[model samples]
Target: MPDERTKYAWRKAILAARAQVSVAQHAREAAALAVAAATVAQPGNVVCAYVPMRTEPGDLAMLDALVVGGATVMLPVTGAPGPLSWARYLGPDSLRPARFGLLEPTSQALPPSTVAEASAILVPALGVDRRGVRLGRGAGYYDRSLGAADPDTKLIAVVRDDEFVDELPEEPHDRRMTWALTPGDGLQQLHV
Candidate 1:
């Protein structure tokens, strides 16, 4: 299990690095992420995806590509805030401001168990090791929500290229991702 200090150190370092990224660079990477996301999704699949916030990599572009590819996409809707509930991604127009500076779909909220329907879940991560250990934003929302997912569900962590690392401190409760999706490298499967 990861010690509290280790988790904090990694989060602080990655956030600092991410803050140095230029707006122009982030936009370019977001576009590339869209291309990679299109390839990861297949027609008629259900995908659970997150809308990037602040310096988080891969914005709605990835979710939009999943829609264009004929996949049913679900985005998180922050409510009382244990495990996140979900809502369908209708389009960019469907999003509205929500708590914690998040943009959520205006559609009806679905139960957290809704993630079990996903064939693939594109999660937001600060970093992920090649071993599939994902470092999130220190909130355990995804960690809680993902526990109900089907074992076959593909968990993909979306991060910047440099965020892919050799190892990360992990916990038994932490769900490991099956893949890491980066802007430059596209989608790379993780081997635990």
Candidate 2:
């Protein structure tokens, strides 16, 4: 496994690149991602997803698509740097600004173990690799929360097409993604 320093460098470089994407390009990608999200949203399944930050690969429409496809969506509620708490995602109107400039659901928070209810979890990542390693923003919240998910639950990392790379630094505690969803690629299975 690569050291934390290497992982930190990768995060910095990838985030810098994402920051340079044009607004038009970001919107187009987000639209395509929304369509792709619909394909994996099984009816009546609970999908744990997040409200994407401005530079992230998706938009509110992606979560909306999951709901329209008959899936119940749950979004993470930020707290101390630990396993994330979750809340049912009612709709766009249900979100309110929270810490770290993130939009979170206004509903009552569910315990971290509630992640076990999800059949699929759409994880946010700066990048993911062919071997299923995910590069997150260094918060470690997803790493902690994902441990609560059932072993069979599908972990899908949402990123831009080019962000699906050949390799990324992996630590023992970093959970592997079962699949990757990109605007151009739709869904690509990773070796987990």
Candidate 3:
């Protein structure tokens, strides 16, 4: 476990660093790269993306491409510090405001059986590293909830381009990222 103070500082640093990337060309290029990476997803790759919040950015415009390409999409729901409950994408009608200022699915959450079905999961993190250490939103909720990720699941972390780095202070329990996503680059398989 990370010391709370270090975790807080890391989160602040990451958010601040991400703010520097406001150029239209940068954003456009990054989105295009991310979307292209997602489009290459093979069938049976369960894509676990998030509803953006706290300034974490992604290419929402590419969702239809992912759907039309025949890949499965699921989003994480905040639960009682338990296993994450996933729901199949049903478009904008399924979302509602969630605690901690995120959009959550308002419709029916899928069965627990669905959680282990994903082969690729896109997790939201403050930062991630070459070794896959993830700095999340200080809750450890993802670590707790995804304790049961399928062995084949690609536990990828989504962050802005600058957040991908060579190292991060880590703890024994920190979840390792299998992949890291950024706008400039689609997805890079991490060493973890």
- Candidate 3 displacement at residue 2 in angstroms: 15
* Candidate with maximal TM-score: 2
TM-scores, in order shown?
A: 0.95, 0.96, 0.84
Off by over 4 Å in 2: 1-5
Candidate with the larger TM-score of 2 and 3: 2
What lDDT score belongs to each candidate, Candidate 1 first?
0.91, 0.93, 0.71
Winner of 1 and 3 under lDDT: 1
Ranked by lDDT, the better of candidates 2 and 3 is 2
> Compared with the true structure, what per-residue lDDT tens digits does model 3 show for residues 3-74?
344767788777776677666854585467457556546775667667766466665544545566667778
Candidate 2, residues 97-123, lDDT tens digits: the string is 999999999999999999999999999
Q: Write the per-residue lDDT of candidate 1 for residues 115-139, one digit (tens) a residue.
A: 9999999999989999999998877
How many residue-pair clashes does candidate 1 contain? Answer: 0
Clashes of each: 0, 0, 2
C-alpha-based local distance difference test score of model 2? 0.93
Clashes of 2: 0
